[model samples]
Target: GIQVEQSPPDLILQEGANSTLRCNFSDSVNNLQWFHQNPWGQLINLFYIPSGTKQNGRLSATTVATERYSLLYISSSQTTDSGVYFCAVGRSSNTGKLIFGQGTTLQVKP
Candidate 1:
């Protein structure tokens, strides 16, 4: 079994600010993903970085398997970015069952 934890617990920022969220896992995982749970409770996949770096617009993520950790970066934050960010990992590469972290709640004020 694998366990995940997210840091900062909570965050607050103004528009245009930048922030970094962290995720630490207890064991080796074959798959990892970053997700944003919107106010409506919809989980939006942000990244699928299992052992590398990836960027999409104002968001980016990096995972280090050796360190058993991952990071999510948000640049020029906006109110629209406010949500609960989650880090999920799967023990088996092909398994869709994932264990999620406690999540980091971000609040961006306009």
Candidate 2:
């Protein structure tokens, strides 16, 4: 079993600001994914960074499997970025079931 934790339980950012979200896991994992749940409760996949770093426009993520942690960086935050960010991990033995951690909720004010 693995445990996950996210920092900055609550965040407030002005529109166009930048923010960094962090996730820490207690054990080794084979799959790691980042998700953003909108105000309407729709979940969108942000990145599947089990290791190394990846960037998609204004969003980027990095995972260090050895250190058991991952990070999501949001550049130029927008009102659209206001939502709950979640980190999910799946073990190799598990059949694609992701264990999610408590999320970090971001509020971007215009």
Candidate 3:
């Protein structure tokens, strides 16, 4: 079993501003996932980083498996970026049981 926690439970930002969100896990994991829950309540997968760094346009993520933590970086964030970011981890892909972090809520104003 693993525990997950996200920091800065809430965030407010002006359009174009940058932010960094953090996620920590209690134990080692075989895979980690980052998701963005949009305003419409759609959970969109952002990254699946078991370790190392990954990027998707203005967003990037890095996972340090040894430290049991991960970070999501948002650059030049837009209003569309406003959403709840989640971190999930699981022992293995086969288990399909992921532990989710509380989530970081981001609000970007125009």
Candidate 4:
């Protein structure tokens, strides 16, 4: 079993600002994922970083599996970026079942 937690619980940013979000997990995991839940409740896949780092557009993520933690970076925030960011981890790599963190609620003001 794995436990996941997100730091800051909440965040507020102005458009064009930059921010960093963190996720921590207990125990080892074979699959690590990052997602963004929109205000309308749409879950969008952001990243799948079991280990190492990945970058896409204005977003990037890094996972240090050995330390059991991960980080998500958002550069030049926008109003469209307002949502809840989640980190999920799975004990079995092929299994879809995963433990999800409480999520970091982000609000990007215009």
Candidate 5:
């Protein structure tokens, strides 16, 4: 079994600000993904950084496999970036299931 946990649990930011979120896993994993759930409950896949660093636009992510943790960075934040960020990990045994973290809720204001 695998377990996922996210840090801060909540965040608040102003437009053009920056923030960082974290995720920690309890067991070895085959893969990992970051997601953002909007107000309408639409889940958007943010990253698939299993053991590396990646960036897109104002967002970036890093995963340290040996440390069993992952980080998400948001630069120049906007109101559109306000949502619940989740980290999901896939077990090595191929259960075809992703254990998700509690999520870090972000609120961005003007």
Candidate 6:
């Protein structure tokens, strides 16, 4: 079984500011994904970086499998970024289900 944990339970970022969110896993994982839960509770997939780094627009993510940790970097924050960020990991036995952490709530104020 795999366990996930996220840091900085709460975060406040000014518009245009940059911030990084972190996620740590307890055991080896075959799949890792980052998600943003909007204020309305809609889950949006941000990235699926099992290893290495990836960037899309002002958001990027990096996963170091060897260290069992992952990072989500947000540049140029906006009001729309105000939400809860979650890190999910799936063990080898699971095909599509993910184990999600508590999450990091971000508040981007204008």
Ranking 4 against 5 by lDDT, winner: 4
lDDT of 3: 0.95
| Local accuracy of candidate 2 as per-residue lDDT tens digits, 1-110 | 78999998999999999999999999899899999999999999999888999999999999999999999999999999999999999886353889999999999999
lDDT of 6 by residue, 41-61 (tens): 999999988899999999999
All candidates: TM-score: 0.97, 0.96, 0.97, 0.97, 0.95, 0.95
* C-alpha RMSD for every candidate: 0.7, 1.3, 0.9, 0.7, 1.5, 1.3
Off by over 4 Å in 6: 93-95
Question: Which candidate would rank higher by lDDT, 2 or 4?
Answer: 4
Write model 3 residue lDDT over 1-110, tens digit each, in one string. 68899999999999999999999999999989999999999999999998999999999999999999999999999999999999999999664998899999999999
The candidate 2 region of ten consecutive residues with least summed lDDT is 90-99
Off by over 4 Å in 1: none
Residue 106: error of model 1 in Å? 0.3
Query: How far in Å is the alpha carbon of 63 misplaced in model 5?
Result: 0.1
Q: What is the C-alpha local distance difference test score of candidate 5?
A: 0.93
TM-score of 6: 0.95
Candidate 4 TM-score to native: 0.97
Q: Is candidate 1 or candidate 6 better by lDDT?
A: 1
Query: What clash count goes with each model?
Result: 0, 0, 0, 0, 0, 0
> Which residue pairs overlap in candidate 5's backbone?
none
Scanning candidate 1 in windows of ten residues, the lowest lDDT window is 89-98
lDDT of 5 by residue, 23-47 (tens): 9999888789999999999999999
Q: Which 10 residues in a row give candidate 4 its minimum summed lDDT? A: 90-99
